[model samples]
Target: MDELTSFVALGDSFTEGMDDPGPNGTYLGWADRLAGMISTHQPGLRYANFAIRGKMLQEIVDEQIPLAVGLKPQLVTFCGGGNDLLVPGSDPDALAEVYEIAVADLRAAGSEVLIFTGFDPKHTPFLRSLRGKIAIYNSHLWSVAERYHCRVVDLWSMSVLHDRRAWSEDRLHLSPEGHRRVALRAAEVLGFKPEDDWSTPWPPLDNEDWMTQRRHDLKWAREHVVPWIGRQLRGESMGDGLAPKRPELLVFDGLGSAEAGEAAWKSAHRA
Candidate 1:
């Protein structure tokens, strides 16, 4: 809040910016977008993103949290457990307990911690059954934020995401536009004056027939869901060969220039 000089983000694909591909095919999610915004205000801002796709909550805690705390950044944003919630027999309360512990540790290390609630899956086809689990997790996340005095980017309350355009075809990650809106909302939460309104209504949509919708669902299942389940059964992850995009806190190279720092960062990474 006090003109962040250093920031670190920890989470799964949501924070990793899945589906929001950059020029080099890496993610450029809300965290990177928000970091770009912060750099505009303070060009020398140092940022790191420890988020990796398909990571579970415990894996984040064990792998990324300690490193984030070690960085001692002025700001840290963490969002995880969505992957865990999808697994059969997962407990929301149990997940929250571990999550809270990580939050507490980060706060104890003298950083302003930011956490996010799970998005509602009501409108996401094939994911409707997990709505109750996500709700329970979100409620617990709110309580954790309150108790820890941490800031929250309440994704659950973002009605804009209820629109189908906000979701990727997988229905798990957000589309590019959706990530942009989320970055704006995160900026708002961090006490920054965002240029655009995240709550702005999306344009109207065309209606589709039931048979057409069913065919789309089947295609989605075949293309996305089946492979996801296969990976789960094989104990494989999307992040198997991946590493964090920004593993260290460094000055945002393209800050405040005509080309935004995010583009510069992407280009630099590609090089």
Candidate 2:
């Protein structure tokens, strides 16, 4: 079998399961759901979620990518930089540069395939002011993925019909149902699963009890289940950090870690 053991999810609030008011939001975002799907259908699979809230493109370049490479995942996912668009100054070109660096690093670390996600304007705030910037960044994502021969998951076009209700109250995060749909679309795009495979209905959340239950479930998913599953996938004896065979987990060397990034770039280029 093609050892699809280690799968890692990287990015920001959306990746971390932010607004979704279900078991998924607290931690079991689509990454977790996909992991679960893989496990249920294909036993012995393992996965990890390393997403953090409020992260930007620079952060992924400097920090998240390293962490992912250390795991030695056969498959990896990057869903990032929504917060970059939240403000200004960091233009799409700058963000694209960051993405380019991260992708290069991923390839060097032996990740055979990477799944890169695009932004969803429907869920995006400040679109009127930031449309061009978002489009540029998304375009960069497309271009970079193409360059790297990585798969690009177009979340932007997929989430258009889903309105605010599909998202959480903050309008920034996805609702549980919304996350489920996103997972389905992502799976479809990545060829992880077929359209008919998404027939399993996620728990609906229209009332307070469902909301409260979802909150608790979300917490359990992140703080407990995710880490546990990650550990299992790595095939290591019980412990933290990454397996010995995996590379060092470094998201970015640092914003100004020029020496570190230069070393990485040189090393990767040589490979």
lDDT of 1 by residue, 1-271 (tens): 6767999999989998888876566777788888887776677999899999999999999999999888888999999999999999999999999999999999999999998999888887677899999999999989999998999999988999999899888888998789988988888888876546789899989999999999999999999999999999999999998899888889865323343344322321100
* Candidate 2 ranges beyond 4 A from true positions: 1-3, 21-25, 122-125, 159-161, 195-271
TM-score of each: 0.93, 0.67
The residue pairs found clashing in candidate 2 are 62-251, 62-252, 63-251, 63-252, 64-251, 66-250, 67-250
Q: lDDT per residue, candidate 2, 132-183, as tens digits?
A: 7777788888888888888776766653424555666544567765666666
Error of 2 at 76 (Å): 0.8
TM-score of 2: 0.67
The candidate scoring highest on TM-score is 1
